[model samples]
Target: MMESMISSRIDIIKPSGIRKFFDIVTQMEDVISLGVGEPDFATPWHVREEAIYALEKGRTNYTSNSGLLELRQEISRYLATSYQINYKPETEVLVTVGASEAIDLAMRALINPGDEVLIPEPSYVSYSPCVILAGGVPVAVPTTEKTDFRLTSADLASCITDKTKILILPYPNNPTGAIMDRENLIDIAQVLRQHNILIISDEIYSELTYDGEHVSIAAIEGMYDRTLVINGFSKSFAMTGWRLGYAAGPEVLIAAMTKIHQYAIMCCPTISQYAAVEALRNGMDSVKRMQEEYDRRRKLLVHGFNEIGLECFEPKGAFYVFPCIRSLNMTSEEFCDQLLKTERVAVVPGNAFGDSGEGYIRCSYAYSLANLQTALERIGRFVARVKQA
Candidate 1:
């Protein structure tokens, strides 16, 4: 193979830091994994049943380039009902493989070479990589524990430049579980409105919010036109394997995304589309039940960490708890590695999310309370030993 055989585009980037530790865990036995940000719940029975019915009926063919119209319409209605944001199913929505694909589509469709994408630090691992792969420059704007990992307008404004093209907003954020309320969004919206930057708001964890309702920045005044709201059924409905997600945005952007999606994917899995329809229609009760369970785990983990001397911040949304491990006198990676090797509990190093995450580690509370209880006990022992040394 020639030196240039691999695209320089891909050669420049690094593999996900989240997966590095996870890969090690796969070969280990009796390890309790709090690393991956996946819901441990099975897909709701009704949602699974719907997918089975679709397969039984041989609904295995490809959908329209955008998606099954019925699924899109249901997504439209669900967003309207939940977030007060209206997205026309016909022209403003396009279903993709997952919110990951939706994020890529939005970036690729909107970016030009050398365009800067403002990404807040300690965000989902994929955001900056996707921006880079889309030929956009990823400018990481740091957010700190001092602000509960919330990206303030001041932080965002400081990074904007003449070359900035997009803002990747990942609230109900992955590692930190930080959320921006309506007032926080309004302040950020005010700053965004002054610039020509487009907003790619990844709200995949929207349904998992614990405090007030999840507010879409797209719903904020002056943001609708400039925002591409990315959401999907993976996190909310525990349908990660279903690979179904959709993007709601301006017609022109949607059209561009659909064009790329058509060429790249043609359509999402037809059976999954049917199941997503069921999810948006009749799965709210199931979602609520899961959310309630996650709330319990969230509270338990937050309190347990604080009590055990890790000093965790209370996360208002999502299933992960980020605990400050700086007192242990180790880097995030060293803390995670030592904990996993010694106690058989796997958690991700916070720096895997970004530089600002250096003093912390991300542990998902999506596991059962029993598993969480055991993991915490082991972690407590590990923390005590580290502190004494």
Candidate 2:
């Protein structure tokens, strides 16, 4: 207050575009919100029971700084079984507060001042800000709906410079629901192998893929040593409130991330770690049921948007539908605001994800079919009214 005590680095970061809209949604009555990228389902019963059991048994004490060895071993098995990637639970796996914390830790451990971090845009919101906070320059590489929002080797080549240090690979991407297949990752890997860059692959939505199995870049040849795979129980296991995630990679980088995590977080919540262990070991049936329901909502929302003239590309992963709203002749923010004020149906403006997202709006399909139907009806009315004017 005396002399503007906030550091310039903190000043440079913008508030999350997602939460900014969500704040407004909370104030309005009967507003059907499609804004937040959160699962609408409750945490699976078995997983919740595990946490409850932990608390009942007085399992409230902190585990090792690297997190419970049992949980890490479960994470190791889950990764190996699901993705054919193996990480030693003892040395290579470090559990953290969430994938959010893991992402921050990775950035803090890897970035040097003025280093460049290539973030594929129209992706998750946290990547850029975390890089800036870590003293790195964030270079947003735009990907288009033309290629289904997948970052290509050519795109990688164009953005590379001597200063590029880390590439944030967010697949099964947020906002757009785009996923990078093996071929897409292989192309990008070839380009990255030539550079001294490391990769932070956020695979939080890996289990939510609708088309084929999700691919992790670390499993790709020539990439394992250079890739830190960030994943968690938040998305796939419907455990967002649990605050548990883990990172696996070459021990060197994992060790570095663990060092920061130990100082910053020490470990995740003890009960959440127990819940997540149950999630890894036995929550697949619940995950499948949720994914199936989200798929139903996804189909309904995409069809409804197209019928209303908001043409949305079918997203192959995650639970969001990014639809082009440019034909309505408004900025994404303007469109979202007007829609909220008029119909009370809330979705985030796509620009919240990146500037590349300006002409679109991201509608999450994680709600009930009844809610989705109501929101869709209201949105259709909004689109018609705008077009007629």
Candidate 3:
């Protein structure tokens, strides 16, 4: 009886596939987890210090519904300097609980019932469910290893229907760590130009890009007005626990999202907002340091996976590596489960992201080199045993 009372939307979506393995890891001993995408680094010292200082000063009052003006200004300045896209702090930016909240807000504010949202799979697991909750149909456009997992112009053009309303562009992608370069975006933009779809560019991993500078689709000519840029301090500044992110887009959309935000969230954590102001103002150097370390680990894991016979692609952004496991003749879940039980290493199965990811597994390099090295050795043994079997 109680189950029937729950919303149909809530019932239809499965629990996060990432969390399912993580929960099992928590119950086991000696598991080296490369499953979660969170930064292994702590929030940068200065950012944490700012949060402590804010608490001491008793600045715990709720910020305006849109967010603290100071943090918004810093976000505006950071975007301008980093991505060459400009948004007015006063009207075009909305501070969200995290990029997660910004994503939900964008979906809720834009999606009408039956409107379709295009999501490229394998992607972060949230996109499809969020669209469903907001009464939108999610249309998956599959991308492959052939294109480095990018959503190509042909793919985008092929998926569009008259009902399609929004396209979620999650680059420096979670689970895959694939990034779309400027040339890639230019091609995607050319196709989007003929359509009237709005874009929600989830750029939370923007600062973690390893090859060249990260480019914002919003920065491309004729794309800015139609794109909602979502970014936060989590990945770059290692401020995942801070729960601060922002959305920059047109004033009309920002206002709509803010209205929903005001009713649902009221405001982001006050101390976190304050800390984020410092993160944007004084955090780039720390970001560069972390990026450098991630780059080192990235190379280590890619080489290790390939050496172990799991065809791994070199990721140019983010800290995860997606390695193909089809050669082992087992499913992604079967490989991950057996590896965890036998070798005590936890990595997410590729199918957790989407069906297209079924033959791959995502291993995060965010772990320490020592832990990663050990995990790689364990995985190597597991792969050998599986092959022998």
Model 3, residue 74: what's the lDDT?
93
Q: In candidate 2, which residue pairs get closer than 3 Å at backbone N, Cα or C atoms, i.e. clash? A: none
Query: Given candidate 1, what's the lDDT at residue 354?
Result: 92
Residue 22 CA displacement from its true place in model 3, Å: 4.2
lDDT of 1 at 12: 67
TM-score between candidate 2 and the true structure:
0.98
Off by over 4 Å in 2: 15-22
Model 3, residue 16: distance off in Å is 4.8
Taking all chains together, each candidate's TM-score versus the true structure is: 0.98, 0.98, 0.98
Q: Encode model 1's per-residue lDDT on 1-389: one tens digit a residue.
A: 78768889888698765676667788999889997788999999999999999999999788899999999999999999999999999999999999999999888898899999999989888888888898889999999988888889999999999999899899999989999899989999989989998999999999999967899999999999999999999999999999989999999999999999999999999999999999999999999999999999999999999999999999988889999999888999899888999999999899988999999999998899999999999999999998888
> How far does residue 385 in candidate 2 sit from its true spot (Å)?
0.9
